[model samples]
Target: MPSNVPTFTDLLAGAKRSAVHLEMRDTYYSNPRFESWRQGHCVDWNDRASWWRPFHQEIADAVARGVTVRRARVVSEPVTEYIRWEHYVTHANVTAGEQVRWLPRRLASDLLLPGNDFWVFDDTSVEIHHFSGDGDSIEDEILSDPKLIELCASGFERIWERAIPHEQYEIH
Candidate 1:
């Protein structure tokens, strides 16, 4: 990404209307949180203090300011263990006021998707995330080109429309 581009934190902090994220990978083994979960560290749902992370706090703060936040995940059916854990702990996202949904990959077969995962802020900018085959983050690029932004924003909506809300989606 160019040095002039604002970080996702900055962009989200400044978002006035909406912010949306789309995650399509089923496994992100390199994520420390995922690794911890894989090693038996689980969120104590009864204890908010134990699992309230900064990322969740960011979303919460944004929501408090009236910035609508949404997230959609496109996953393969018979989900990977990482996705199962993510589903188990998604309540934090809900508590943070993000509207999250899940779309089975099979259902998204006909939809055109971006080459990378992304976050669209206020429909004006996109932060595209690149990852390796094993799901390790490689880099992020922020783009404000109208065409790219439109593609991501529209694609997110289509997936969101077909997705099952977090509360309604069951792990297969």
Candidate 2:
């Protein structure tokens, strides 16, 4: 028998309007869902070295549209590699008008705290009960919280500040 699994769309039907806050460990961005979201211009986070390709493409897209994309890392190596490989070597076809930013890992954590209003911890083991009082139902709580929207916007700003300018990185 096929088990009834709830998909994001199902959850979204009942979810509130607040912007989502997704938290994942290093490298979750490699998931196909992340790639789809990137292609659609949605924001995401991951701290792994292997995500350079998708990350580069996402950033390049954001830049070309004259949108600012920000990121943060707890460590420097991944960022450095991203700079060298994606920015320097491939010289991915990014537009001159786009802007990118990065932030230290500590700051990334600060923006993800409890008081931020609505948050979405995207992973396999999260249960609806765990988020009961901590925030709102992915289906219902966010629809009413304006604060959550602001918090997400603020988080994006921090990432923007720390990111390196594309041209400065030596695109190969």
Q: Which candidate leads in lDDT? A: 1
**Model 2, clash count?**
16
lDDT, model 2, position 13: 31
**lDDT by residue for model 1 (30-145), tens:** 67777788899877888988889899999999999999999999999899998998898889999999999999999999999987899999988999999899988989888899
Ten-residue segment with the worst summed lDDT in candidate 1?
27-36
Which parts of model 2 are misplaced by more than 4 Å?
1-25, 29-93, 106-144, 167-172
Q: Model 1 segments beyond 4 Å from truth?
A: 1-3
lDDT of model 2, residue 53: 59
- Whole-model alpha-carbon lDDT for candidate 2: 0.35
Error of 2 at 142 (Å): 8.7
